[model samples]
Target: MTYCVGMLLDKGMAFMSDTRTNSGVDNISTFRKMFSWSVPGERFITMMTAGNLATTQALISQLEERTKAPSERKPSILEAPTMFQVANIIGTTLRDTIAARALTGPVAASPAPNFNASVIVGGQIAGMEPRLYLIYPEGNFIEASPETPFFQIGETKYGRPILVRGFESHMSFADITKLLMVSFDSTLKANLSVGLPLDLMLYRNDDFAPFHERRITADDPYFEKISDSWSEALRNAFHSLPDYELDA
Candidate 1:
């Protein structure tokens, strides 16, 4: 399992993802789940994936190959004129990969390997507004709107509340990063399958390139600070709330 989030803000877009995959308690590994491609001053794209590791890996590899050698059947992600088209390419690739895997054998049988996966693709094209999308296993996707400015995948429930309560359109990139970190921290604390060494990408509006990118390890000073601070803040908030009293 893993956790990844992409946010759409007035200033730009921000994405964060964890690098953890586990088949069992004793079978654990770390693998990068974020993929990106950019053409300076032209276009930029980033995708975060979760679900069956093999399925996601194959999906990304297929897309990467197509970009290198695009065909009518397999168009390059960079060639897409619009973010919407880029998303369609990704969604089709994902759904096709899973379908092919299903042909090999039963994906849902007990002790059977799974071939289900999902992705969140976010970026900007030279001529259009920045966009964010959540692509599902079935090749269907939904874009972020004013009412829903962010999308998360993999172990999402543990961290969604923070985003729901904190996201804002006008937030600066810095504030958005902090909010996302807190959300990731919350997910990490509650879920064993999602571990650290996080990938973060920030793109300023109309840049057509990544504005900032970094990796946050468990020992990263800033992330450490955020985790500690959030714990203390949550405790304080809990204590500050009024307790209910029963009439005797």
Candidate 2:
């Protein structure tokens, strides 16, 4: 399991993803779940993955190879004229990768392993406005909108409430980063599968490149402060609520 979020903001876009992967309690590792590609002034694309490790890795590998050899691949994300087209290309590639794995892996007599993964992709092209999309395991996707300006994939429930309550379209990048840290901290406390370090990225509108990017390690002082402060705040808030009394 993993946790990843891509948000659309008035200033631009922000993304965060945890780096933990595990087959069992005994087998745990850290692997990057976020990736980005940019062409200086032309375009910028970022992707976050969740679900089967192999499927996600294969999907990312193919996308990377296509970017390096766009002429051979024909329709790479870097060459896609619009963010919508880029989403389409990524969705199609993910669906095809899963299908190919299913067909080539095991015989039909037995149930195949789960080769399913989902992706959150967002970015901007030269003339187009920034866009965000959630691409499913089946290749279908939906774009983020004013009504739904953010996307969260994988182990999402533990960290969703704060985002729903606190996210504001006009919030500054600093505030947004703090909000994401709280969200991730909550998930890390609740689920062992969602361990850190975490990857964070922020893009300013029309910049076509990341404005800020950082990896928050377990010992990072800012993250530690956020976690402790959030916990204390939550406890104080709970205590402040009027206590319930049994009916007479």
Candidate 3:
């Protein structure tokens, strides 16, 4: 399992994903689940993935190949005129990759492996407003809007409450990053499957390039501070609530 979040902010976008994969308690590994591509001054694109590692890796490899050889592959995300079109291309590619993996034997005689994955993609193109999308395993997707301005996939329940209470459309990049850290920290504490070092990316609207990007390792001092501080704050808030009195 993994955990990934892509949030739309007035400033642009923020993405964070954990790097843990496991087949069993005894078998665990770390692998990045976030990727980005750009055409400087024209477009900037970022994606976060959750679900089958094989399917997500294959989908990303195919997209990378298309960018490298657009003339041969066709409909590359870099060449898509709009972010909407880019989402369509990614959705189609992801769906096709899963389907192709299932055709390994006689259709009626063999059962397909679970090649299911989902994506959260967001970015901007020249002349168009920044956009964010949640693409499902089925190849269908929905754009983020005022009513639903963020997307989370994989082990989502453990971290969702922090985002629901803290996110703001007008928040600065610094604040959003802090919010995501707390969210991931909550998940890490609750579930062993969502271990870190986390990958983070921030983009400013219309920049056509990432504003900042980094990895937060287990020993990062700033993250340690955030985790401790949040726990203290939660305890304080709990204590502050009025006590109930019962009739004697």
RMSD values for the candidates in order, in angstroms, are: 1.6, 1.4, 1.8
lDDT of 2 by residue, 1-248 (tens): 99999999999999999999988888999999999999998999999999999999999999999989957746989888899999999999999999998888866645567889999999999888999999999999999999999999999998999999999989999999999999999999999999989999999989999989999999999999999999899999999999999898
Residue 112's lDDT in candidate 2 = 60
Which pairs of residues collide in candidate 3? Answer: none
List where candidate 2 sits over 4 angstroms from the true fold: 107-112
Error of 3 at 83 (Å): 0.6
Roughly what TM-score does model 3 have, to 2 decimal places?
A: 0.95
lDDT of 1 by residue, 53-152 (tens): 9899999888888888755475778998899999999999999999999888775688776789999999998878999999999998999999998999
lDDT of 3 by residue, 1-248 (tens): 99999999988999999999987777899999999998899999999999889899999999999999957747899999999999999999999988887776356754545778999999999999999999998899999998899999999998999899889989999999999999999999999999989999999998999989999999999999999999999999999999889887
The TM-score of predicted model 1 comes to 0.95
Best by TM-score: 2
List runs of model 3 lying over 4 Å from the truth: 105-112
**TM-score for each predicted model, relative to the true structure:** 0.95, 0.96, 0.95
Model 1 spans > 4 angstroms off: 70-73, 106-108
How close to the true structure is residue 22 of candidate 2, measured as C-alpha lDDT?
A: 88
Q: In angstroms, how far off is 244's CA in candidate 2?
A: 2.6
